[model samples]
Target: MKNLLESPPDKLLTALRDILAAKSIVSPAEIAERIALTDAASPAQGARMVARAWTDPDYRALMLHDGAKAAEAAGIPMRGMPPLGVLADTPDLHHLVVCTLCSCYPRAVLGYPPFWFKSAAYRARAVRDPRGLLAEWGTVLPSHMKLTVVDSTADYRWMVLPLRPAGTEGFTEAQLAALVREGDMIGVTLPIASA
Candidate 1:
């Protein structure tokens, strides 16, 4: 029972571990040491890209033209990592992403995807019927924006830099985070405001 409680899904884990130090399977220090976070380069590139896209129309245009090159222009060095690319959500086409084999994500841009994103249901259903999944995520898209699901592999990762939402003219970066839904970044939602 002690070991079973420590398994994930057991809320008692935190309580027991806190009250009984000896019962703790993993120390805070050990957990911290085991965890691996992205380097500064990752978020730095994402921040730079977001700022450029916000302020520079030409840069956004350049990004839409070519993702990899846009990253280079945005001062992101990508040669060391597997090919980093960007996906622009357009009015005519919506892009959703998945890694069928494993979680191949653009950590440099989007950071870590949610736990659900790396789930088997998401990976399987994303490719099976993307539109249905988007609708389930509260995104109702028009027939115009055709949905395209892209699979990220071990050699490559994917990120969805969704289209800027309407009514957000001149909004600051902090404000934009609110408009940018997790589903939108996951490619399961479009940039449509709630009714």
Candidate 2:
């Protein structure tokens, strides 16, 4: 109370919420729940899908057709939303996702979004010209296949879900899953198994 009336702005705001919570105006659990929730599931989920796609053609088809159901079929619950869609990034094609107004993502498939996705530079230009944005990420796609860029507003969020490289054709699901990196899942890069 000593600092609330006459202190500078930063000091007034500092520790302000904690004070309010102590007074029972807002429970600590309430704030924790708000901050702890993520826009999507963790990136590990995407890696699993990609690995399954490489090994099982039927499972792959299911994922591409109905991603949400496919995820639950694989044991990851689709937190709240429905109609999950999986955008596959092929050898010649690339996919990137954005939400112009807000970050709408596939929490069950992709997981929490990276910090860069929320930045002003990414949000502004990703929709206007996605190819340029991919270039900034060092992602180059053949000009022939359309770069399918989806939007994840409140209604949807996306997972990049990278394609498996050629060398690992005989790899088991474990090995295959290892190659799908976070950047690959977000459409920034493709996973190339190291020699």
Best by lDDT: 2
Off by over 4 Å in 2: 1-40
RMSD of 1: 7.7
What value does the lDDT take at residue 56 in candidate 1?
75
Per-model TM-score on C-alpha atoms: 0.66, 0.74
Estimate the Cα RMSD of every predicted model relative to the unseen true structure.
Answer: 7.7, 4.9
Each model's lDDT comes to 0.68, 0.74
lDDT of 2 by residue, 30-127 (tens): 66665455533577777888888878899988888878777888787665565677788776677877777766666666676678877877888888
State the weakest 10-residue window (summed lDDT) of model 1: 34-43
List the pairs of residues colliding in candidate 1: none
